[model samples]
Target: MGSYQDIEGQLRGKRKFFKQYSKIEVDDLPDDWIDQYYENGFFTRQTGSMITKKNAGEVSILTLAFLLLSHYPNEILNITIATSDFGIIALKNKVLREANSPPLQLNVTYKPPISYLSTDVSIFNAVKTGLIQPHDISSMRPNPKSSIFVEHFADGSSGLHETVIDTPSFVQICENPQKYTIVF
Candidate 1:
């Protein structure tokens, strides 16, 4: 998560995305991690302020569940969601009873919930469904100054992480692959 300005500026350039999206609709999540949002739909605030990519991670799990349900309904029998979001675990336990139940038809093999999940589309969907809070409303934003690399590991191969050279788009892959994911 970049600064709120950075996030808005980038999203503004791509206004087309908002046409199909809303920034305010939030998941009626519980502020108390122990109480959980899925069961109550609302909860009193306990933590100082929920921040980071927690909301994003929660949203992804919901989206993944919905997508898998609709896209591959008949073939799915079970799904093992892999995430580190408390919200995901909450929903999985409350709505899906994740541990004991399977997908309606297609069997998903996702890792179990972790504490710090990477922001992705699956989490985005959970936000859309009101399972997580809006990203901007949260108090924390990831520091872009600290270079983070997102590498895709697939097919028994390790992809490389590269340095960020420019920032009109917050980050642009370095021209030279040898630099790794460095800031300078």
Candidate 2:
């Protein structure tokens, strides 16, 4: 969490594992996911396409769920994902069960505003885009960092991810509102 480089190195290992284990080529897979193989490049003959294909459906669904959560929080909270994929099903159960999880350091609407000027305002409305992670102290905080594919939002109110906005970034953003921004 402290070093972004270390985080990327870990992901590189994970990507290598995926590349080594996934045998199915991009052309043989769904059109929606073809770009992934293009991005990952060719793998060895030892790669397991059959095994990869078997799990592909669930992975796709889970990815969809995350993207959906990113845009429409309410839709995810009110929907169902009936698939064999334990991952997707787990996420469905989680969202259906928990209504208060915050993704990407973003929390649900606070129960009450600290002041009249601040209450009931969209973080987007109040701050510029990409500002959440910059201006706010919580953005750099130790979030239970999920992969790029994982949903940033909470499945429930309690266990989503940590929010640990680091000191330097926090100080910089706080001192200059025009300097910060939100990604989503």
Candidate 3:
């Protein structure tokens, strides 16, 4: 087993990645995460959607996951995004346009969190399979840099299209706290 110091180091690294990319403060995360970029210092696109500077970075799955882990120390989060919301689609397009990259045609399971914003089946499986143990932060520490989507697909198929959190999924995870307890 690795020492506690090693595990802590990994968590710190993940946090750093999140900070470097998202630039969102853990304490300032709005309850409505989809509206996060609407604040000042963010710019609006022709699509009427908001995103940070082309270089400032948007919040990634890992960044949001780490924020949840930091704030709610005693929860196991199961993240489920609709994968077709406008906010998300815009973000993907913006990232690609800014990066001058071609359409990254990969299964949902293969896209990097930095480039895309959708949560794949792998993330859900991690919680269900106990890889992200409920209520224990330590178990998640060792693989802090690991995308919240750590578990793999069973059938090896391409995953969901990248998108934003839809109304239903967002409400289910954030609003219905009691029923969807510990889920993000």
Candidate with the greatest lDDT versus the true structure:
1
Model 1 C-alpha lDDT per residue in residues 63-179, reported as the tens digit of each score: 566566656666666655544233454564443444223423223334422233334323333444556554431232233322234443445444554333123222223322232
lDDT of each: 0.40, 0.38, 0.38
- Give the deviation of candidate 3 from the true structure as CA RMSD: 19.8
Which regions of candidate 3 deviate over 4 angstroms? 1-37, 46-65, 85-184
Model 2 stretches astray by more than 4 angstroms: 1-34, 37-51, 87-184
Alpha-carbon shift of residue 78 in model 1 (angstroms): 16
Cα displacement (Å) at residue 63, model 1: 5.6
Best by TM-score: 2
**Candidate no. 3 TM-score:** 0.22
**Per-residue C-alpha lDDT of model 3 across residues 1-184, encoded as one tens digit per residue:** 3478975775576556445535555466668654433332232233347433332244364345434444554463344444322255456455444332222222222232333333323344455556654344333332312122211244654233223433334323333223332211
lDDT by residue (tens digit), candidate 2, 51-99: 2333445545544554555566664443344332224434434433432
> Residue 87 in model 2: shift from native, Å?
5.4
Candidate 2: lDDT of 98?
34
User: Model 1 reaches what TM-score against the true structure?
Assistant: 0.24
